[model samples]
Target: MQEKALSPTVSTEIITLTINGTSKQLEVEVWTSLLDLLREPLDLTGTKKGCDHGQCGACTILLDGKRINSCLTLAVMHDGSELTTIEGLAQDGELHPVQQAFIDHDAFQCGYCTPGQICSTIGLINEGKAKTLDDIRDLMSGNICRCGAYTNIVKVVQEALERNHKA
Candidate 1:
């Protein structure tokens, strides 16, 4: 009689990502979600994990300047991609325009969804697809704020769009 191994060796891959304007090379398990990699080893806890299934949009992040649910993607899948988390939105002690807008408009409650909402709004602005109020609502519907801050959130986004156009 002999003991047998129940599983094979774990697979891992090294990835380079430009996060928050910094380049990092990290070795992560193949199956590790981007959300896990961010919150765990990178210690970036601002990206929430409300619903790991990607339905809640709590883990939304800017991957290559586009918004994507970090929980829905694998860390290995985004090699060579540039990512921006909430932590990176502020620079040199000054918050990004959208971040400042959120604060000015008080667009958050409980603050759980603020990070995702802000990131999504930035992506939306970058896409240049949201033109009107309804367009903003439709484009931002993916990110939910259980605190019911939709009104102020919309205002913040609208202001951000205007600011971008004026820039």
Candidate 2:
């Protein structure tokens, strides 16, 4: 009996992105989500994987300085866009203000959602969306912390914003 040849599977498509400060090109599957492509292909694991669905903000990343749920977006859709992850927020081994605020305020419990929280906060600050406590709450509603440290998270974000404003 002769074995039949199996059809080849295309696992990647050409993708180009400006991540952090550098440009990157990689062959990724058309259906691959930005989260997977970022974590697996690019080795930028700072973006955590929670509920692959958009319900959770665990896979949040900055697209052109705006926070977006990476799991809900396709890698190819952002071909020429600028991308920023938790990894990009730090510079010269220094944590971004938001990241430092989270640490200072003990904003996270399990630390599983820290990256998303930080990313979302970055967006909220950059967009000037986190003005009042209610505004912060509304803006961060999408990112859920399983440990329920929301109060501290809010404080951290607000504090970070204040510090950023002062700087």
Candidate 3:
């Protein structure tokens, strides 16, 4: 097989986005995913790099108040959008309800997936699509926790849902 020479492509664009309540402006390659945007220059590593293919939901983040797999979309695509990562979910040195609920319920192990879990939980709650344990499981099916802590995770979700509903 003859090796074909590939054309080199280099294009970088400047984008501004609200990340974790901070406005960030950065120049990046067009192919950079939102996950890389957070992890690279922005240095927000709370969003995990699991699977890196949008399957595990480890890179889940809130884009414009909705949850999305950050690994699936390009950074330039979300210019001027609001993004909330695991780090952004907290307020005034206090954990977000979902984070607190997860801690109170011991909903994590190994901790690789906790960040994603937390972000996903917040997103799920904001979505208001889960009204029951089953609904939570079905809706949160994308975030894979190898620790098999689904029971505790579900409990946290249930608590957060009830609490958020009251508010």
Index of the highest-TM-score prediction: 1
Clashes of 1: 0
- Model 1 has an lDDT value of 0.94
Off by over 4 Å in 2: 1-12
Cα lDDT for residue 9, model 2? 66
Deviation from native of the Cα of residue 70 in model 3, angstroms: 0.3
- List, residue by residue over 1-167, the lDDT tens digit for candidate 2: 76556956666678789999899887878899999988997899989999999888999999998889999988988888999999888899998878888988889999999999999998888897577899989999989999999999999888878977898
RMSD of 3: 4.1
Q: Put down candidate 1 lDDT per residue, 50-108, tens digits, no spaces.
A: 98997878899999999999999999998999999999999899999999899899999
Badly placed stretches (over 4 Å) of model 1 are 1-4
Q: Which ten residues in a row have the lowest lDDT in candidate 1?
A: 1-10
Clashing pairs in 1: none
Candidate 3: tens digits of C-alpha lDDT, residues 85-123: 998878999888788888899999898888888888888
Which residue runs of candidate 3 sit more than 4 Å off their true CA positions? 1-7
Considering TM-score, which of the candidate structures 1 and 3 is the better prediction for this target? Answer: 1
TM-scores of the candidates are 0.95, 0.91, 0.93
Candidate 1 residue 163 Cα shift, in angstroms, is 0.9
